[model samples]
Target: MPIQTRLFVRFALGYLLLGLVAGVVMAVDPAWRFLWPTYLHVIVVGWLTQLIFGVAFWLFPRASRDRKRGREGFIWATLVLLNVGLVLRILAEPFDLGRAAGPLLMASALCHLGAAVGFTANIWPRMGSGR
Candidate 1:
């Protein structure tokens, strides 16, 4: 699998583990104060968000097809920053310092966003309406 695909799979597994653990926690201690929110942040921001981004970047039209300058760097940086940010978020949330993870995640999002835009630009020319 491509690195991007690997990243997506890892992110998915991360979320699944978090969910299973959350379920157990809920079952054991339904009165936990931060159950839902904590889980939401991790699963949504840390997991699903990363998962979607990785998949989008991996499968995005022209993502792998284009070998132009800086494309690989952008994609790899996206993978690194996304996972690093997610890890930071996961660590920060439990200690009530989740804000610490915000910047990293934002940077990661920007990288992925740039990659998506680049991919779109690369493929757009090939997608004409037969004009």
Candidate 2:
């Protein structure tokens, strides 16, 4: 596997562990119930989506020579944005951080959206023409 693929997989595994730990904590302590959203997002977006992205990137057809696997920079950006968004959501949502967290949450959402766009742009060309 490529370096990017390895990184993605590693991230997915790490998130999976974190999500599971968070879930267990929430289950064990009712007071921690507010963290459900954080755990859910950590598992879904951080673990599952990232795992899919890594596997898809590894298994998908190669891009044409003209494109060269879309753009390495964009893929890196996607990785960064996705992680940043997840981290922001995890930090901001679970605490009673008050109004200060609003902008952080919004920025997290934008980061996720940007990551999706970046991943799409990088992967589209690899889908190959019907011919």
Candidate 3:
């Protein structure tokens, strides 16, 4: 598997573990129920979506003989943006850090959007007929 694929898969697994732990904590302490959004984001965006992205990137048809996958830079950017955005969200979401957190959360949302765009741009051409 490509390094990017491995990185994505590993990160996804880590997020899954983190989400499960968070869920357990919330179950144990009703006070932590406020973190439901954080746990959901970790599980869905960080784990499930990332896993799908990685596997799809790997399983998708190649772009060409010379360039098997699409642009490497885009893939890298997608990985970085996704992981950074998720980390930022994990830090800012449940803390209620007021104004500072608002910007961080916005930035995180942008990063995630960028990741989606990057992934789409990189993978679109590969979705064609493998002539």
The best candidate by TM-score is 3
Of the candidates shown, which would achieve the greatest lDDT relative to the real structure?
A: 3
The runs of at least 3 residues in candidate 1 whose Cα sits more than 4 Å from the true structure, single-residue gaps closed, are: 63-70, 96-131
Clashing pairs in 1: none
Off by over 4 Å in 2: none
TM-score of each: 0.60, 0.93, 0.96
lDDT of each: 0.59, 0.89, 0.94
lDDT of 3 at 121: 91
Which candidate do you rate higher for lDDT, 1 or 2?
2
lDDT of 3 by residue, 1-131 (tens): 99999999999999999999999999999999989999999999999999998998899999889999988899999999999999999999999788899999999999999999999998998889645
**TM-score of candidate 1 relative to the true fold:** 0.60
Which ten residues in a row are the worst by lDDT in model 3?
A: 122-131
Residue pairs of candidate 2 with colliding backbone atoms = none
Residues 2-90 of candidate 1: C-alpha lDDT, one tens digit per residue = 67668767877777798779868977897864667667766775567667766665554452246522255555655565556555545
lDDT tens digits, residue span 58-131, model 2? 77887876765667788889899999999999889887779979999999999999999989988987887767
